[model samples]
Target chain A: MTTSKQSAPISFERERPAGKSAARYILGRRLSRVWLYTLLIVTGLAFGLPFFWTISSSLKSITEIYIFPPTMWPAEIRWKNYADVFTIAPFARFIWNTVIVTLLAMLGQILSAAVVAFGFTRFRFPGRESLFVLVLSTIMLPWQVTIVPQFLLFRYLGWINTYWPLIIPSYFGGGAFYIFLLRQFFLTIPKDLDEAAKLDGASNFRIFWNIVLPLSKAALATVAIFSFIGHWNEFFAPLIYLNSTDKFTISIGLRYFVSNPFESDEPREAILMAASLITALPVLILFFVAQKYFVQGIVTTGLKG
Target chain B: MAAATGRSWWHSSAQRREALEGYLWISPWVIGFLLFALGPMIASLYLSFTEYKIGGSPVWLGLENYIRAFSQDKLFWPSLNRTAYFAIATVGLGTVGSLLAAILLNQNARGRNFFRALYYLPSLTPVVALAILWQWLLQPQVGFVNYALYQMGIDGPGWLTSRQWAVPSLILISLWAGIGGGRMIIFLAGLQGVPQELYESAELDGASTLQRFFNITLPMISPVILFNVILGVIGSFSVFALAYVATDGGPNYATYFFVLHLYYNAFSYFQMGYASALAWVFFLIIFILSFVQIKFSDRWVYYEFS
Candidate 1:
C-alpha cells in the first residue's frame, strides 16, 4: 500500500495574510482541536468514574450510601468492610478455590498450546495445512454449541461438583486462539537453530523443549497471562458444574453474596462492593504489570489474520 | 532439499518419522477434539432428536423438540427476538464507538497511554462485578445516573426495573465494559497500518478531510471493522452472565437472552432435549450469519495481498 510519491509537507498552521477567511480558518482549526481534547477527556471520565465510584462506595457507611445527593467520596471511611466481607461469606475458601483452578488451568493451557503450536509450525506432514484450518475454525464455534453434551459427558463420568470440568479442558488444548498466537510466534524463529540442534544428535522433541521453548518465552508469557485472566474471571462453567457452596469459585461466590437470604432485608451493599473490588483487583494488577503482552496478544492475533 | 534426495514418498524414513512426530506432538489437541468438541457436537445433535433428562435414558422423538421450539414454546421466539435486537444494537453502536475511541487514541496527543488505560480498565473487571456496579449506577432513586438526571431537572427512567429501559440499560453496561477493550486495540492496530504518506499525498491533492477519510481510511480499516462486527455478533448473541447477575432476565423478560433461556431449560428445568434443540437452532443462525458475512466481505474488506 506504500506509495512511491514524494510530497511537500503541508502545515495547517501555514502563515496567511491578515484576512477574514484566513482568521476564520485558523480559529476553526483551533476550536476543533479544543473540541477533540474535550471529547477525549469526557470519554475518559465516563469510563473512569465507575471504577472510582465502585471503590468509594465500598468504603461508605450503610446510611451514607443511601443519603440523597450522594457524595462522591464516602463521608466516613469504613475500613472494616474489607474484613467484614470475609465474615459475611466464605470468601477465603472461595479465593482459595479460584487460585487453585486458575493455576492448574493456566499450566494446562500454556503447555498444551505450546506443544500443539510446535507441531503446526515445525512439522511438514501431509494434511497439516487442512488440520490447521480445522483448529482455526474452532475459534468461531460458540461455547453454547458444546455446553449441553459436555455437561452430560462430565456428568456421566461422575465429575460433577469437582474442579475437573473447569481444569481438564485446558489440557486438551486451552483454546484455538492461543494455539494460533503461539504458532505465529514460532514461525518467526530461525530454522538454523533447530537444524544445528538436529546435527548435534538432538531429537525433534529435544529441539522443541531446549531451544524453541526458551526462545518463545514472551509469546508463552502472553499465553499464560491471558489464560490466567480468563480462568480467574470465568463464571459460567463453574456455575454449571460445581453445585455446593464449598466448591464455588470467586465469581460464583460473589453471586452467592449478592443473593444471600440473610442479607435480603438489610443488604450489605458496602460488603458486596468490597467483595467485588477484591474479586476484580488481581486482574487490574496483572494488566498494569504486563500491559504490553495484553496489547501485543490482541493486536497480533486480530490484525495478522 | 530433503525432498530432492527422496527415492519415493512412501519409503522415505525421514518423512515417516516427521509424520509420526507430528501426530505425537498434536495428540493432546486431537484427543481433546474427540472428547470435548467433536464428540459433544455429535452427541448434542443426537440429543436434539430425543427426550433425554439428566437421570433418564434417551427416548427417540424425531423433530418433536424442534417443532415445539418453533410452534409451542412460549419463551423461544421472544427470547430469540430479544437476542437479535441486543446483537444488532451492540454490534452497531460498539463498532462505531470503539472505532472513534481508537482514532482519538491514535492522535499525537499527551497522556495517550494514560487515556487508553483509563478506558480499558473496565474491561478487566469481571462481568459479575460489572453487573453489580452497573446495577447500583442505574438505580432510579439513589443511583448516580438517575441522580445526575434529577439534578438536571429530568428524572431518569427505572433502568433495570422498567421494561422500556431494561435492555437499553444492559446495552449501556456492555458498551461501558467493552468499547475501550480488544475492539479498540484491533482498530488502533489497523489505523497504524495505514501508510502515513497516503494522507500527505491526499492533502497535496486538495482532498477534503472527509473525502480523505472516506476514500483512504475507511477502505484500509474495513477488514478490521468486518472482523469486529462478526465477533460482536457472536458475542452479543451469547449474552448471559450480565443479564443473569444484573437483571436475571426480568422486568417482564425484557432482557431474557437466548443463552439464559437455554440455560434455564437445560439446568433449572432439566429439559436437555429442548435445550439441545435450542442450541442447534442458535448455532445454525450464527453459522448462516457468519457464512453470509464471509461471502459479502469480498466486496468491502481490503487485502494488501492479492
Candidate 2:
C-alpha cells in the first residue's frame, strides 16, 4: 500500500506549512515513522523467533537438549543429528515419497485445471453457466462431509495403504478454487489469437496446446506452485490412506517417531526437531521462491475456504 | 445456437457439435464429481441410517444412529461443546488480532515487503511440524516458555499435560501459527481497496483518527471482515491435525474435538454408522450457520456500490 519508501503513516500525510509550526509538524511525522518502524520490527522478530528456535534446537546434541535453561544456540552444532534422523527412521524414503506425491499431484492439477478452465473460458454450450456455478458452489462444502464414503470407495477399490488415493483425485481438476483461478486467468487471454488459429483449421486441442498454453505460463505456474505446497503439507489424506511404515510420508514418519513407545524417560527432542525441520523445509523454500505467485493466487481467487 | 425442434439425434449440427465438444472438455470434472463428491455423499447419507461396521453389510436400522447420538452417547455432546468453544475463541480472537496486524502493516513505513513475508512464514509451516515443534517448545520443565517463566520467579503451568490448560494452549499455538496468515493478507487487500480520498476528506473535517477509522474504514471493510470470519469458523471447527498430534485428545479428553471423536468412532472402533451420523450433523450445522450469517450480514456489511 505504501507508494514510496519515505512516505509516512496516513495520519501524517498532510501538507507541510511554511510557517514556524512547520518544524513541529515535521517532528511529529518523524516520531510517527519511528513508532511505526519499531512496532513492525518487534512484531517481525516475534514471528521470526520460532523458526530460529527450531533451527537452533535442531543443531543441539541430545545431552544439551534437555538442559534446564534451553540453549538458544548449541555450543557444538550437530551435523550428525541430520544423519541420525535417517538412522532412527527411513526419513530419506519419506522425503522421496513426499516428493513423488507432490509432483504427480501438481502435474495432474495443472493440466486438468487448465483444460477445464479452457472449456469454461472458450466454449459456449447449453447449461455452461449453471455448470460452472455448480463447480463454484462445491467450494463451500467441507471435505469432512465426503471423506468417509470416499475412504470406503477407495477401500473397495483396494487402494488403501497405497499412493493411489492420495494422487488420483488431482487428475480430476484439482479442486474448485484452482479451476476458478485458472478460468479467471484464461479469460484474460485475447480471443483473437485463438480466432486466428481457427482460420488455419487448427483443432480445438491444437489451439489450446499450441496457441493459448504458451501465453498462460504464469497462471499455470501459479496453479503448479499452489498445488505443490498444498499437497506437500497435507497431513490428513496421507495419514489416513498410507498406513504402512514403508509407505510413510514425512508427516507420518515424524508422527511415528514421537508417538512410538520408548523405555527412556525422555524422547529424543533433538532428533524430532531435526526431522521436523526437514519435513517443513521444502514448503518454506517454495514460499520464498514463489512468494509473488502465493500473493497473486490468493488475491485473484478471493475465496480460500 | 441450433433450433431444438429441428435437431435430430445423429445429426451433427454446428451448435450440437460445439456443445458435445464442451462436454468432452469438462468430462474430467464431471467424472470426479460422480466418483468423489456426489456418489460418496449419497453413500455417506445412506450409511448414516444403517448399522454398518467395517467389512459388514449395511443393515436397516432407521433413526437408531441419530437417536443414540442425541440421547445415549455421553462424549458426543461434550465434544461438540468443546469444539464450539475452540471455534468461537479462535474465530473471535483471530479476526481481531489479524485485522489489527493488517492495519499496522498498511502503514507507509519502510521494509514493508520483508516484514510481510516474515510474518507469513508461520502459515507456510506444515501442521505436523508445527504441532511437534510447539509440543517440544511447551515441554513444561524443559520448554522455552517455562524457562522464561522460571527466570521471572514463577512456575509455569503444565500446558499440554494439564486438562485446564489444554484447549487454551492449543488456541495459543494456533494463533501463533495463524495470526499473520491468510486472514492478514486478505485484510491487507481489503485495506488497500479503501479509497484514500475518504480518509483525506475526513481528516480535513477535523475528525480524530479513531473517528475516521470507525466512520469510513470499518464500514468499507465490513464485507471483507464477514468473509474472513466465515472462513475462520469453518477452518477452526474442523481442526483435527493439531490436537491429534499435540495432545492426542488426552489428559481426560480435555481437547477432544468433534472431528477427533468422529474419527475415533469410524476408524478406531469401526463405528462407521455412528461416525457417518456425526458427519451429517456436522455438515448441517455448518450449512445452517453459514446460511444464517449470509442472511444477516446485510445488517452490518453493506457494499459500497453493488
Which structure among the candidates has the greatest lDDT?
Answer: 1
Overall lDDT per candidate, in order of appearance: 0.86, 0.82
lDDT of 2 by residue, B1-306 (tens): 335733563255876788789888998998998898888778889999998888989997899999999999999999999999999998999899888778777665556778888988888888999999998878888988888789999999999999999999999888888888878887777776666667667667886666667787789778778888887888888989999999999779999999999888888888888888999988888888888888999899867655
Candidate 2 has an interface RMSD (Å) of 5.9
The residue pairs in collision within model 1 are none
DockQ of each: 0.40, 0.39
Give the CAPRI class of candidate 2. acceptable
What would the per-residue lDDT of candidate 1 be over residues A186-282, giving only the tens digit for each residue? 9889999999998999988899999999999988999998999999999999999999999999999999988876544765777788999999999
lDDT value for candidate 1?
Answer: 0.86
Per-candidate alpha-carbon RMSD to the true structure: 5.2, 5.2
Tens digit of per-residue lDDT, candidate 2, span A106-147: 899889988999899888777787888889877778788888
Model 1, runs deviating above 4 Å? A1-31, B1-10
Q: Kindly report the interface RMSD of candidate 1, rounded to 1 decimal.
A: 5.9
